[model samples]
Target: MERFQRLDAVAVPIARPNVDTDQITPARFLHKPRSDDHGNYLFHDVRRRPDGTPDPGFVMNRPEYAGAQVIVAERNFACGSSRENAVWALYDHGFRAAIAPSFGDIFAANGLKNGLLPVRLPEDVVAGLIAALEAEPGARVQVDLEAQTVTLPDGSVHPFEIDPFSRHCLLNGVDELDYTGTLAPQIDAFMNRYGRENR
Candidate 1:
């Protein structure tokens, strides 16, 4: 997992709500090897037409936001099934963070484990961000995890809420397993004392 202190990147506005995991990475693409190259399959159905050609109308197909690393989406984003691959697809596609009004509970947990920042903000704030990004294509949004704020293009900042433990994990690039491993010394000490008494 990579440390995520702050990020300033091109924002891709996905205006849809309830974008489930199946839509993110279709079940067909799930059979492929579990690697970090799922970017090629991100939004597979939306990005490709029936003829297997690029669909020019898709937001990701637009050349300007092709390499966008941040996604601004509507409410209830990442809702529905809880497939970890969905999070992998987003990360593989270079999206380090997603801003929305809410997210599926399971999806949010999966995202945090995989180093994706699923930011929850007010509905109006999310709508404003979408509108701003649409109006100014290729505009960058800065997300500062350390400061717990989202900096808009106009120099305005919006504060957000994140669990303290999750925040710590993201800041240090540590996953749940890594966090547990941090207590190795205490575990070893307890085991040693118990073993001596058992003898």
Candidate 2:
């Protein structure tokens, strides 16, 4: 996992709501064992037509939003079943942060563990971000995890709250797996004490 301190980059607007985990990566791409190259399969269904041609109208296919590092979307982003692959796809596609009015609890947790910042803001603020991106293509937005603030294109800022543990992990590039590994020393000590008592 990569440390996420501050990010300033162009934000791609995904206006749709109720975007589920399957839609982010699709079931067909789940066969691959490697996380690499999943970016090409991100939004596979929406980005391709029946004949497998690129859908020109899709926000991701648009030239201006190509390589965007942040995504501004509507409410209920990343809903449905809990799949960690969705976070992988987004991160692989260069999207490090997602701003939405609401998100699936499991998806948000998965994202945090994978170094993707899931930002919760008022619906109006989310709408404003979408409008800004639509009106000005390639508009840059700044996300500072340390400050818990998002700076819009026009220089306005909105604050968001994040769990302290999640924030600490993301800042230090430590995932849940890393946290578990950090407890190995204590676990070893406990095991040694238990063995002596049993003997």
Displacement of the residue 42 alpha carbon in candidate 1, Å: 0.9
The Cα local distance difference test for each model comes to: 0.88, 0.91
Q: Which pairs, if any, clash in model 2?
A: none
For model 2, the local distance difference test gives 0.91
Which residue runs of candidate 1 sit more than 4 Å off their true CA positions? 181-199
Candidate 2 structure quality by residue, lDDT tens digits, 113-167: 8889999999999998899899998999999999999999999999999999999
- Candidate 1 matches the true fold with a TM-score of 0.89
Window of ten residues with lowest summed lDDT in model 1: 27-36
Deviating ranges (above 4 Å) for candidate 2: 181-199
Residue-level lDDT for 179 in candidate 1:
62
The digit string of per-residue lDDT tens for model 1 on 1-199 reads 7888999999999999998888998888777887549888888899899999999988878888867888888888888877788888999999999999999899899888888999998999888989988888888989999999999877789999999999999999877886678999999999999999999
TM-score of each: 0.89, 0.89
User: How many clashes (backbone atoms < 3 Å, residues ≥3 apart in a chain or on different chains) does model 2 have?
Assistant: 0
Q: Model 2 misses residue 167 by how many Å?
A: 0.8
